[model samples]
Target: MSAGGMGPTLDDRGARSLLRTIPVRKGPDLQWAPAEPPRRNAAMPDARTSGPTAGRKRDPLIEPRVFEAAVRVYARAGWGGFTFDAVAREAGVGKPALYRRWSGGEELLVSALHNLDFPTARDCGSVRADLLDYARQWVHWYRHPDRALAGRRISLDSRARPALAALYEEMINRPRTEAAREITRRAVARGELAPAVRSSTLPDLLVGAMSTHWESTPEGSRARLRRTFPAYAETLVDIILAGAQAMPPRP
Candidate 1:
């Protein structure tokens, strides 16, 4: 991989790449829609009233509620408190229902995360513009509370759990790997980057810089990052490309 922003890792792009499991606002500042209790049909028993027994009835609304509750539970408590009992309580469904759907918290969390929606990447025909857009989008994504929390938790906690680690590989690692390769390949084909330029390095540098900036910044000061990210992204992209140009071709 090249040294600066060639193949950006999914780990760094977690906030940017996550599918909107919940409804999300479009554009650069993607806001998560508020979670509401799934509407109950007139004939269906109130989940709160029926309590655990409510899981006995087959309702289409139940599944979405369970998935949404799972995300919230995982986002708030992370891997430690992400248990069926907790999720069931949050969803107002029985634990048995969760058990039937997933063998454990890892499976449930993965399923929930996978079920979310993701934004498509823009192909501006210029690698510079593409990478800048990616970096800016990542900044906007970090501003989302649930996604940032979930991404942080996954990055830290996945280290301890094998299943969670696998989930990370699937959700974060694989997708970014593909994206980085495509971006670099396009750059090379366009003669913007040397044919021998490392595919992963440049993207890694770009997103790595962005991720480090976000992590190092205190929460109280993030508004500044949000405001300054466009210029910051441009500078980072230019620096990486310039450095990439100076690098000698490797065998």
Candidate 2:
């Protein structure tokens, strides 16, 4: 300013302001520094990156042994005897542990029924095959001693225990009915079944027939029933499918 502007010499502040106006030059040697990664606590493990629990083996949501114990208790003592304390004693776990998983006896029974792994309806490209597969699963379930015993006990007590019956209808029967409905729906969609065919009750009829047959079979003849149930399942499916096909279309 003194030489060019013909003015008084600038103060320290004015000189600093003039320096700020200069553009910075970035050269080949000027590279951005890499940012440092966040540090992790070595003592504490992250649960998300690990399993359900960190630094501990993950536990099952409902243990198989616990489910078996619940079934055993229910089968042995019916609804009245199916208490949390009884189930815990049978399962070899504390009542608190069982409570943590299920709120009450009904919920525990529902979970046990779920653990049976009922077959879901699948698309086998043909209604006949789909029905057979579904029925076959029921045959297997009926033959299993633990599951059959539990189911028989529930069926017997359904009238006396309305709450248990409601739970069973909601959790078990509803899903099974829905699966069977899906098979009929698929058949109608493919033109194999008439749109107005009343096949909604087909699953019930099949299940009722199976249950009656099972109950009527004498204890001494259970082995024979086991051997014959597969063929019976096939015949049952065939008869239902034939009737459904022959049903007149609704007006």
Candidate 3:
């Protein structure tokens, strides 16, 4: 308390007393002993790196919504952005559920696209009219940024991702083949054309002519044939009718 009392202030007295009782610590902790270097251990592969995927079968009970969300996610983000964890988070489900249903992203994407039914009914008054309506529906689908961007994305992935390609095939190509068969079948029924016109060829002709594009790939630019499609359908109908009328009458 007093500036220079020889008995010392309480602080000085306490410091001196503590110094006497405290043990001294020794110098620099040099405990590491130098020795010959041991052989380096090889790195272990991660559990995921070696997991089974070659022939893994998906669980049979996948929910439709999960698959749909997965496709939308992948279509917008592509493969790099997709993962079981990401999809589960987006879908409000556990990651394991998605994995159980789909071994990988491709299967989920393909299944989702397959779920989108193309509009191809047989009655638009005539096959020609039906095809035109179908073309209009396709144009509506294409004009939507969601479907266009999705279609473009899936189309690109298809080379390495066969299932996505198969999805496209099922929608675009298969329906064309089937619808053509239907059209030919109708013609036969109505006595409008020869039964021997080859049903298969009818689809080929229609699809080939209607679907011709500037780039000729799913990823390519659609031919500026929107105006031409309906026009061609009408002319095609007229030509087919004329040809049928000129042929010998059906027995």
Candidate 4:
């Protein structure tokens, strides 16, 4: 294990607290569509009377832009800040347009979560390699400037909000957890890991380590983090694998 490979020593509460340490920088917001002046009325402009493209039936980009905007807003501000007005302002659309599609922030946030691109881990030749691949993918995705701040915020923000927490489980946790479980199960089948190892908690450890690493690092140093991510990922995987391998078999 590398010098930094002390696998997450924090307990659940400590880890949760650490996850919230890094303040989410609002940063440059997502601006998929061109900005338009706010309209007093919540209703969107009639497609027929709108412009030269009036002949077209609908703006296909509207919902997509709205969805993207909703995510950005939720990521930056969490559940409280995730409002139709906020999404509308970000998406460059009228508030009523959002109301027309979704009933409330929870619904809109769910739709946004649905639209998010979830990363996956493929099976590599070895357990170590497989974990490294997953870790690398996890680091790359969450480290993105577009996602970094929002991802962390949403994670902590979900704790108190049952609805948000459920969405997090459905959209984020379940897939990643399943992938981790598969990796560990494959490892056991191939004799790479002992069956007695606490396989179930492995996902949380790996993800917690990654999240903690992100939270602890200074914002100014994240560019370096991105560049050095491969080495970090390798070390992280090795550390996790080493710990699992070291666990004594249960009688």
Candidate 5:
């Protein structure tokens, strides 16, 4: 792997294949829908309540609820509190049900993170606009109370939990890195970015900056950060694009 684990890995091909299956929104109107309201049932609810199970017969609606519960529990308690019993209680499901789906908490947490949605790269006319849209979307998600808490908790525990570190790279980072790579690749193809640009590192640079900003900013000042994030993201993109343009042509 390259610096910051940004370069393509052995699994890049497989990751791209999986990404193709995910829906990609086009144009410039990207927006995040609010999280689903939590359900009240103690157990898995019938699928018929929402719609016909039809093609989704194999997967229960409870699975998403369990995933959400697992994230909440893990976010609040970290690795020590991420127990099956805790998740079961948070999900209002039996421990046996969780055991049936996941062998342990590590597996449950990885699956939960993987189940979280990721938006695909879009061709929004220019690299600058595309990057701004992507950055804005990410900032919005990072500001979401539940996702922000979960992300911070996971980042903190990743150093001690090898399983979490690996799973996070495979399930979360790889796909996102690939998405960023695609944006850069498209920009280069369109002559918007210099061919000499080290496109692989773009994701790491952008994502790392966002994560660091989120973690380092005092909680009291986060509201201000949220309010100004769009302008901040735009400035960040401008710097990056300018640097890419300034790089000498690749030999």
Candidate 6:
């Protein structure tokens, strides 16, 4: 039924005539067209809706809801899986509200990682202890199964969309790297790390360990991780710690 009346009341010819009278202007279309059936942003990992502008409204997501939806998006679809529209849908709001601030899924993914609440080893006063705590926090955050799923999405999205990959590396991984570096630095200061150990390598060791751990024993993924992640993390950390001690002396 249409505003005019029951649509079936008109025959095919009459409907044709009505449609012919309607005009469509060839206005400029957006760069990205909505894909058929709209099966998530699986195509372009960077697929995003409009972003917040100068005069745009304040953030539509409140504290907990924003956090909650982000995790959902990451877990359900991964980093690339999250978009303003999806977030809006998850948050039960209009997509335009979320778009006003973030340009794409990458921005939203980065935001989620920042809110992960991983404790620093600095406060713990022992680098190794800090790492254990960091690992504990990492496990806790990822224990939800959603985090692991998000990690996988982010990894795949990184290859599909380089700009988005850069965003994740810069906004998310880099900070984690820096945090890990801080722990290594403390250990070095305490003479726990070999004199030859390079602080820069600290992040590499951790990243490698984490990547391997997540990639190998992914939870909530189509494939399960070969081994238990908790046990893996413990061993992985130990290996990195050993590698740090084995580094040839520098200067």
Best by lDDT: 2
> Residue 228: error of model 4 in Å?
1.1
Candidate 3: tens digits of C-alpha lDDT, residues 1-251: 37665655558778766555533344765443334444554685455554676444654545666765676677678878877777787777778877766777766666665565434546566655654555555545444434445656776777786775776677555775577578667766776666766666555554444445312434333444444445555565456546544666447
Q: Write the per-residue lDDT of candidate 4 for residues 91-186, one digit (tens) a residue.
A: 999887877777777667766655665556568977888778788777777665555666666778778888878877887767767877888888
Q: How many pairs of residues collide in each model?
A: 16, 0, 0, 0, 0, 5
Model 2: per-residue lDDT, tens digit, 1-251?
A: 57677879879999866655534346855544434455789887666677644444436744787898998888788888899999889988778788777878888897797777655666789888888888888899888767777877776776687887888788877877787788888998999998877557566667778888898999999999999999998999899888888977788
lDDT of 5 at 189: 92
Point out where model 6 deviates above 4 Å: 1-63, 78-81, 118-123, 200-251
TM-score of each: 0.64, 0.70, 0.46, 0.66, 0.67, 0.58
Question: Lowest lDDT 10-mer window, candidate 3?
Answer: 213-222
Provide the global lDDT of candidate 5 against the true structure.
0.76
Reference-based lDDT, each prediction: 0.76, 0.80, 0.59, 0.74, 0.76, 0.65
- Candidate 3 TM-score to native: 0.46
- Model 5 C-alpha RMSD to native: 27.5
- For candidate 1, write residues 1-120 as lDDT tens digits: 557859865564685456424667779788786556567789987657777765555667877888778878888987778889999999999888888778788778766765543222
Can you write out model 6's per-residue Cα lDDT over 1-251, one digit (the tens) per residue? 78777565778998766655433344674343333333565554432544443354555446457656877877887544566777777877667655655676677676675666633334478766776676766666556666656666776778888887898788776776677777777887888886666666765666567766665653466234423556666777787777777776676
Question: lDDT per residue, candidate 5, 49-148, as tens digits?
Answer: 6555444344487799998898888878888888988998999987888877887777888788767654345668788878887888777777665766
How far is 179's C-alpha from truth in model 4 (Å)?
Answer: 2.9
Q: Which ranges in model 4 have alpha carbons more than 4 Å from their true place?
A: 1-60, 120-125
Candidate 1 vs candidate 3, lDDT winner:
1
